[model samples]
Structures are given as structure tokens and as C-alpha cells.
Target: MAVIGAAVDSETKQVFDAIARSRSVTTSRLAGALITDFIRAEKGGQVVTTKAPGLPAMGHAAAHAGAKTEQVYVRLEPYYYDELGRLAAQRRWYRSAYLANLLYAHVDRLPVLCHDEVNAVRQVARQLADIGRNVNQIARKVNIDPDRADLSAFDFELVRMLLDVETAAVKDLVHANLRTWGATDVQ
Candidate 1:
């Protein structure tokens, strides 16, 4: 394994660190996956573009709270070093950020959502939560005062069925989103 030392800007390093922390993996491991994916894409003749406008930016606190730059040393096979150099040169991107862009492009398990899609998902989630709360409240009231709660006209089975259907739909939507983002084992 040859050590490839690269200087990454503070923001990019912070972003990588944040993602690594979230995924409970080391930065080096994440970098290795990114490099592997990049190489595979290149070899398959896929145009690997670095642009990801949908990714959320690192928080303001994180952006301002690190060294201006940092050194990342990854131990890779010798051939990867040459390939990385060639690809970075071809793309005219800094070596460290080139790898960072690959990471951004292929975040595992994170569904990349456009701004409008995010808003739409949030709205649906909020509505689902509200419905859940209402159901729980009604159930609590009925349990506390069965006679006064007026369950004579309410169909508990129907409500349960509807909730089940919505739950399945939400799960399907989540699995579809994960699959769309190249994630597997969507359970």
C-alpha cells in the first residue's frame, strides 16, 4: 500500500468527518469506498461528474470550526495513486477535493433529494405524525372513558386498516428512495 498524502480544505474535511461519524465508520474507510467507486465508474466508461447541488452543506458551525486545511493520508495500492492523479488532472480538480466530490456523489444509505422533494417529504411526514398523534389521543380517551368516548359510531378496524396501508406505502417509498440512490439491503 502506498500512502497518498493530500491536502483537503477545512470544509471538505469537516463534511467527510461528519459523515463518517454519522455512519460509525472511520474517514479512511469511507475514502477507500469512494475511491473504489470512482475507479469502477471510470473503468466502466461512465462520466463521473462531481457536481451535487442537492447535497446539504455542512452546518455554519462546522464550516467555521476547523483548521483552514488538513492533511489526509490514505494507504492505497500503488496503481490507485497513479489512477487518482490521472483522473484528478483530467477533471482539473484538486486531488483531495476530487476524492471528496466522489464521496459526496456516493454517500451510502443517504437519499439525495432535491429541495422541492425534501419539502414534499417533510410535509407528508408531518401529516403522518399528526395523524398518529390524533389516533393515540383518541385511543387514550376511549381507554380512559369508554362510555363517554362514543365508540359506537367509530370503526376501529377501519382506522387500523388505513394506518396499515399508509405505513406500508411509507415503507415502500423509503425503500424506493434508497434503491434510487444506489443503496441495497433496503429493509
Candidate 2:
């Protein structure tokens, strides 16, 4: 690694310090990233902007809900690393998060939803839960008094309609997720 140093005005130094503090990184690291971006831009490569780091835009699968405990490190060529950085930048994610998502989806064969898709799926899940509650109540009434159970009051058609809506929502969510992941066979 080579070291590059430059002197800046007091105001510029303050701004750099503030940005480094906001990003929870050292000033040197921030300077390195800025220099790398500048180099990339000058080389006609895509320049990644500094964005607030947060969780990746992938839906949380059941197995991924636990706290991350392990870490892995791999060495790659500069070109490969730059490409990975570009891909992650396109999704507004950290390179690590992007790689982890790819492993989860491809290696684990788990479905990952984007933010909007996750919300849609959650809505469908809530609807299904409401339907389940209603069915449970009716079942309880029937179980309590099998002789005088009134079935006419229950709106079977309404239940069917709700289920249909939920099902369609789920299907649409799946298709949208697949399409977002660049799956060509989305149906």
C-alpha cells in the first residue's frame, strides 16, 4: 500500500472530519474512499457515491433473523473487487451485504424480497392471519355446540374473497421479487 498526503484549508479539513465522524470511520479511510472514487471517475469507471450505510434491502428470511456472529475474508483481484463494489453500489448496499445476499439466495436457495416486495408480502400474511382467526372462532363455536351451530351467519363467500385477494397478492409479490432479481422466467 502507498501513502498519499495533501494539505487542505481549515474549513475543508473540518468538513472531512465531520463526514468521517458521521460515517463512523477514520478520516484517513474516508479520504481513501474519496480518492478511490475520484480515480474511478477519472478512469471513466462508475463512481460510487457515499451513502449512509444500513441494512441491505433484502427481506429477512427466518434463518437470517439471528444476529450475525461470523465473519469471512477473501482476497480478490483489484478488477474483481471493483466490479463487486460497482454491483453493490447499484443496489445501494455494502459489498459484504450484497455478497451475503447472493450466497443466501443461490447457495441456500432462499427467496429474497426487496423493500416494497417485503411490505406486500407482509400485508398478505396479515390478511391470511385475520382469516385464520375468523376460521378458528367459527371452529370453536361449532366444537362448543355441535347441535345448534349456526353456519348461515358466517359469510363463506367473504372468506373465499379474502383468500383470493391474499393469494393474488402473494403471487404478485413472488413475481415482482423474481423480476427484481433478474429472473427471466418470472411468471
Candidate 3:
């Protein structure tokens, strides 16, 4: 197998990462599923675009009735922008419209979290934050009296307890977020 790399915007990467984390899968697996879906769709004649040496001479379709268009600006690497321009030109579409459609299509095809899952994730996040704050408080007290040999053992014990709590909390959060995937702990 060959490894391929691409530079994607942070927002896009984060979205994919979140999905992978939720599903307890690697990003590569998520990407493979998407590629497989695309290939299947193309083979079934759902995707009409073809790659050739020259640009495609197709035109963009008209907007649906009552559809409103929004204007937005995006910054991209020079090479990416150039590639988008070429692809847009091939389909006889304006660059902005082509990019908008591409983004919308990708988002539309992504897996969605249910309302309950969203709520659970939010609750786990709050628990994690509270655990972090508690750890910070313990560390601050320990830092202020590092030279106290008499209390050093006690402080170390407190720190170890806090570390254990924090680690368990993090693991709980990860499990809660990905419970729907029925994934076992690989750690």
C-alpha cells in the first residue's frame, strides 16, 4: 500500500477528527469509507464527472426554486486555489459556487450525532473541565510549599491521587463519547 498526504484546513481536519473520535476509528479508516462510497456512487452512474487530460466542458445547473445563495470568502494555499479554479473551469462553474457546492456536498454526506449523543458529549466535557480545575488547585497548593520536607510525602500522595482521578475522568469521557461504537479499550 502507498501512503498519500494532503494539506487540509484545520477546521476540516477537526471535523473529520471529531467524527473519527466519536466512531472510535482512525482518520484513515474514515477517509477510506468516504472514498469507497464515492467510487461506488460513480460506478453506479450517480457521479457523472470524468477525469481526462483536458478540462470537462459541463455547465453548472440552475438553482432550485426559492433557493437563496450566500456569499462567503475563504483563503486557501495558492496551489489549492489554482486546482479549484481549474476544476471549476472544467465544469463551467464560477469558482465560488463550485467550492460552495463541494463543501455542502461533503458536509451533507457526513455522519451526524444524535441529540442524546450531543448532550452526553457536552456533559463529559463539563466533567473533564471540573476534574482539570480540581487538579490545578491541588498543584497550586503543592507548588507554594515545595521545600516543606515534613509535608512532602503528603503532597506527593495528594498529587498521585489527583493524577489518578484525572486519568480516570479522561478515560471515562472518551468511553462515553464513543460508546455508540461499542469499541473496546485498545490501550
* Winning candidate number (TM-score): 2
TM-score of each: 0.40, 0.45, 0.28
Identify the runs in model 1 with alpha carbons over 4 angstroms from their true place.
1-107, 185-187
Encode model 2's per-residue lDDT on 1-187: one tens digit a residue: 9999999999999877755654456788777877887998999988653431321212333234442436779798999999989977866788988777666555333356556557778877887998899899999999999999989888999999989988987887666655555543666
What are the root-mean-square deviations of the candidates from the true structure over C-alphas?
Answer: 15.6, 18.7, 18.6
For residues 41-138, what per-residue lDDT tens digits would candidate 1 score against the true structure?
87895532222222223321232335343456888788998888876675566667556545543553445443444666787678678878978888
Q: Any residue pairs clashing in model 2, and if so which?
A: none
lDDT tens readout by residue for model 3, 112-171: 233554566677667667767876776787698867524444455765676677567656
* lDDT (Cα, 0-100) at 86 in candidate 3: 87
TM-score of candidate 1 to 2 decimals? 0.40
Ranking of models by TM-score: 2, 1, 3
Please tell me which model should have the higher TM-score, number 2 or number 3: 2
Candidate 3 achieves a global lDDT of 0.55
RMSD of 2: 18.7
**Pairs clashing within candidate 1:** none
How big is the positional error of residue 117 in model 2, measured in Å on the Cα after superposition?
A: 3.0
Off by over 4 Å in 2: 1-92, 99-110
